[model samples]
Target: MRKVLWIILGCTIASIGVLILRHSHVVTGGTAGLSLSLSYALPLSFAVIFFLINIPFYLFSFFQMGWKFTATTIGSVSLLSLLTSLDHLLPSFTLPSLMGAVTGGLIAGLGLSILFMNGASLGGANILALFAQRKFGWDPGKVNFSFDFLVVLSSMYSIGFSKGIFSVMSIAITGFVISYFKQKIALHNQPTPASVTQPLDNAISK
Candidate 1:
């Protein structure tokens, strides 16, 4: 029952995020931001574009992040896509860039936090981050930041440098919040290695 509730909540948050993006006419972060850019230039739907961009990353996630994580990501991605499609039926709103960026970041970050707590991801550069962790043990957040920088750079050429800069800032804020929650959850799950190793060292000396 608890799992079911969490799943429902996750879906709801994901949908609300889609609505936020649609209503605001702004891009969020992650693969979704790239998708938004492509959708703006092309005729593709946001969900379809997102799915296509994400499919290749699935193999990386499957091998590095494991099945449970991959499955949750797939489900969340699907939910986000459906919400994007459904959102087209509703009336859209016009929001200014600054308001859109901040609101989009907050909603999208909160939704991603719920997804992360459930052991999943949105699966774009995030998949790239997992691969980096597997190969070099690099911090996933750092890897994500590097890729986000690339995405925002492209946004500068495609849109304008100012919007791209704002998007970068918004993403930075969102990523920081999500990383903080993730670290807190990780600490809650187990003792820090420094503490555990100290006890072991004392035992060995004794």
Candidate 2:
């Protein structure tokens, strides 16, 4: 039941995010953003490109992370790709580029936060972060930020300098917000004295 609920919720949030991308004409960060920018220049579906680009990362995640983590990542990535494809069918509209940048960033950040909290990823840099953490034990947040930075830097030609700059800012904001919430949640889930005492009492009783 929980998995089903997450599936439904994840797809819904991701679908809205893709709609925001379509309407705003603003590019995002990571592989999805790259796919969007390239789709503008080619005859490919953004979702298809997104899924294809993520495949290798998913394989990396499976080995470096674990099956449980990789399973959730797969579920989230697959749903996101499917929803993005379906979102294109819903409407054809546009919004101001700035508004698109802000709102799209917020929605993407929040949606990804939801997935991340559930032990999943929206794919791309997050998977790479897991690999980095496994190999170097660096902070995953910093690793993900660096990945986003490189992705944005590579976009100068495809998305132009000005828009690429905006994308960098948007991605930074989104990543900061997402990491903030995830950190808060992790803190909340830490063992408290009272909670820890209850487990000790149970063990003594047993």
Quantify all predictions' global Cα lDDT against the true fold. Answer: 0.64, 0.66
Q: List model 2 lDDT by residue over 70-141, tens digit each.
A: 887778767776677675466577887677777777777667655554556778897765455446644455
Model 1 misplacement above 4 A: 36-49, 129-142, 185-206
C-alpha displacement of 116 in model 2, angstroms?
Answer: 0.8
* Weakest lDDT window of 10 consecutive positions for candidate 1: 197-206
Per-residue lDDT of 1-206 in model 1, one digit per residue for the tens? 55445545656776675566446554466787788778888999977887788878988788767787789778767666666677667775766677766776666666665555545567898666545544565555566767777777766776677777767766675666556555432322222465543332233233
Q: 154 in model 2: Cα distance from truth in Å?
A: 1.3
What's the distance in Å from true for residue 42, model 1?
7.4
Estimate TM-scores for all models. 0.74, 0.75
Best lDDT goes to which candidate? 2
- Model 1 TM-score (2 dp): 0.74
